[model samples]
Target: MKKEIHPDNYRPVVFKDMSNEEIFISRSTVNAKETIEIDGVTYPLVKLEITSSSHPFYTGKQKLVDTAGRVDKFMSRYGNRNKNK
Candidate 1:
């Protein structure tokens, strides 16, 4: 309800889900370093690692996303704990 409190740079931005390559457009003021053309129009592009479109909670399916070998690193560090038993 306050004037000049909200950002004035809100514009249509394209958000892409890297895991599934799903894209949707929404208004946002976030800065983007890329651009994407959809339907002959260019919009600021933002890449996301995960979103509701590719999330397990919304799709009811379990999925693993490993970007920095985190899963493998954790597995290597603790995967053999129960092997000796």
Candidate 2:
């Protein structure tokens, strides 16, 4: 351990999984632009596309997370190439 090497801004932050709307609290130093109140206590809100709770590997299920039509765009651009084979 070293002195004055760790960040001092560690605090409780709320991480929300956008796919399943699952939320959990953990201490972090990451900056957040949004806030959420839980149990009458306000905490920084961080939105996540996927987490262990909703991930395919952790949940043993297949899931497709498409944000802003990214998956669609990718499929359109590259998916058709394989179909001709």
Candidate 3:
């Protein structure tokens, strides 16, 4: 609850998630050079790598990688030393 400790230039900005191509509008003080039109209105466009719409924690969607192939490759290269011991 401190006075004059916050920014005064708060405005509506558009945050675009690059991963999922989702856009949302919120109030922020960030400076953006790009502008985007949404619903016949223009807002400062900000590009983001991850957002609530695309994040794994919020959307419960996880990308599964093929780790078994990597493990097998590593074991074939270095796991032979343990077999002789």
Residue-level lDDT tens digits of model 1 in 13-71: 99999989999999999999999999999999999999999889999998676999999
Q: Candidates' TM-scores?
A: 0.74, 0.74, 0.71
Q: Let me know the TM-score candidate 2 reaches against the reference structure.
A: 0.74
Poorest stretch of ten by lDDT in candidate 1: 58-67
Task: Quote the positional error of residue 79 for candidate 3 in Å.
Answer: 8.1
After TM-score superposition, the amount by which residue 59's alpha carbon in candidate 2 deviates from its true location, in angstroms, is 0.4
Please list the residue runs of candidate 1 whose C-alpha ends up more than 4 Å from where it truly belongs after superposition. 64-85
In what order do the candidates fall by lDDT, top score first? 2, 1, 3
Best by TM-score: 1
How many Å off is the CA of 64 in candidate 2? 6.0
**lDDT (Cα, tens digit) per residue for candidate 2, span 1-85:** 9999999999999999998999999999999999999999999999999999988999999856689999899888998997898
Q: Please provide, for model 3 over 19-65, each residue's C-alpha lDDT reduced to its tens digit, 9 standing for 90 to 100.
A: 88999999999999999999899999999999889888998989856
* Model 3 spans > 4 angstroms off: 65-85
Error of 3 at 45 (Å): 0.6
| C-alpha-based local distance difference test score of model 2 | 0.96
How well does candidate 1 score on lDDT at residue 55? 88
